[model samples]
Target: MLKWIAVAAGVLLLAAGMVPLAIIWIESRQARQAGGMEPHVASAQPARRGAVVVYFSRSGNTALAARHIANRLDADLHALEVPEYALGLRGLAHSALDADARRNDPARLRGIRPRTLDLRPFDTVWLGSPVWFYSPAPPIWAFVEHNRFDGQRVVLFNTYNSNIGDDQIAAFKARVMARGAASFEHRALLRGRMTRQIGPDEMLRRIDADWLAGDAVRAPLTARTPAPAAP
Candidate 1:
């Protein structure tokens, strides 16, 4: 009797593991059929005061947000393609493990398109990524770690199904600001539960100027002139 119970528990565990794999397979297949993850740039328009959108998307959720942002800002768009996070069980496992390990090493990001970008020309820059492990994905961290945004307004956006803690947000904001960004702001889209989540259209609708431009954190004033010896 004990042997039978043990066998049943083992079978149940195996089934549980397969369920997620199957779901990942179906979603990955659907995404591929729907024209795999691609960096989308809006119709060519004059960059809004020299703006650009750079983003890292794993399963296209963040890509959608990036596309809308580029359109809203009339800016050029670029996607960071982390080969290590390509669609598949292996890739999914890699992403989760890396994030779980909190590995923000820039070397983990490779083979991304437009290998080098000059951020100096852009007065405003938008960065987007999906929330992984309740934080911005490691590739986003890798990008920020490798680059600086001197004197430019930097905006960070995220698409998350679950909650993003304030601690993570604070840390990421501090890191971006450390890169010499003139200002920083963060925006997030919460899709809620899978059964009642907002669709892509609604998500896009929410990406307006008010949503993007709100809650800005400007760099602290430096070298404030002293009063004339208090008169």
Candidate 2:
């Protein structure tokens, strides 16, 4: 009777082990019967920069600054470019100079776009340009003029050969703000001569003081929340 009891105990242990195996097998079968599952694959869109680097680079200086700022901001970046076939660098120089001649001119680049840059999602718009004559490049001017800022923040990144200061920047700031941009900050980078040099860090340092450090402010067209209904 003792030996029979021992054998019964062994049978119970075997049954207990089998129960878990049975459960696993049953779950596998149920999963298969339901249907084989496939993993989801996501489609990609164009890279969106939290800070859109909108720039007009005639000699690549402004574009370079735009890239530097994008890197410093730890932001994604994009460049809207003109075809080299349409205008070589030399041609671009002449056009930029002529554009300076028409300083007051506000013509958009003919057929130049992703028509409207979708700056709506981004709170910060990093506006970059090579200062042409006494103001920002014409394309840069046109870009600021055409876009409706509504409630967005604007930061100006400007590069020049030599001889520019608050007069130019203040005017540029006024022009952009007039377009309804909520606010702006100015950064200057010197190009073309070794007489003055502003490395990327210095440009970014100034930009941070003016915009990103969060001092300058603008009034919102609408309150952050709708004002309580006036009785």
Candidate 3:
């Protein structure tokens, strides 16, 4: 009887372990298949003005959105890098722990290298990050803390797996606004199974519509230029 009980316990543990692995496999397979699609290219001409996209992506979901936005606007793109972590699931877990520590104790967070960014030329800045435990990723905090956005229009974009990302977006907005950014706006994308439910083109259309509408708070009259006529 004891032997049978032990066998049953072992089987349950094995099944528990296999569940997460199966989920990971399915998500990865779907991502690879979706990767073959040619991303929608924005036909509209880029704004004839200074704009830039800066982002940190872990699973590449945020990177895809960043690329789409940058391509649509024809803006300069910058990818934030950290030396401590590698890419993939292991790196994601490592970064999440790091972000949690930073949230609890801000002083524990370290600054990123390759620190030089000249924000002077750009009037508009698009900041992107993947959500980490209801907070912006650690690298994002490092970058935003070290930079000044005075007199700039700042837009926040985030990618998340399950959560709606309200807390993450709010936290990010408060930080950048405190740094003297002139205006703040945001957009969030749901990834994984949620994305598969909505379809990729729907996501693209939402992003494009938000961009065309200038969804953020109004920029100062001087900073606002009329968008170029669509070709």
Best by lDDT: 1
Full-model lDDT for every candidate: 0.72, 0.57, 0.69
lDDT of 1 by residue, 1-231 (tens): 999999999999999999758747654654553343224535344543477889987766678777767755557788898787888887888888888777455345434454567888788888898887788888787788778899998888898878887778888888889999989888888976534667666776676544655423222113234447754
Which lDDT tens digits does candidate 2 get at residues 114-180? 4457778777888777665656666666676667776778877777766565666776788778878
- Write down the worst ten-residue block by lDDT for model 2: 35-44
lDDT over C-alpha atoms for residue 44 of model 2: 21
Sort the candidates on TM-score, descending order: 1, 3, 2
**Which stretches of candidate 2 lie above 4 Å from their native place?**
1-50, 83-93, 104-111, 165-167, 192-231
True-structure RMSD, every candidate:
12.2, 25.5, 6.7
lDDT of 3 by residue, 111-133 (tens): 56546477777899988887777
Per-candidate TM-scores read: 0.78, 0.56, 0.73
Highest TM-score: give the candidate number. Answer: 1
**Count of backbone clashes, every candidate in sequence:** 0, 0, 0
**Candidate 2 Cα deviation (angstroms), residue 29:** 68
The global Cα lDDT (0 to 1) of model 3 is 0.69
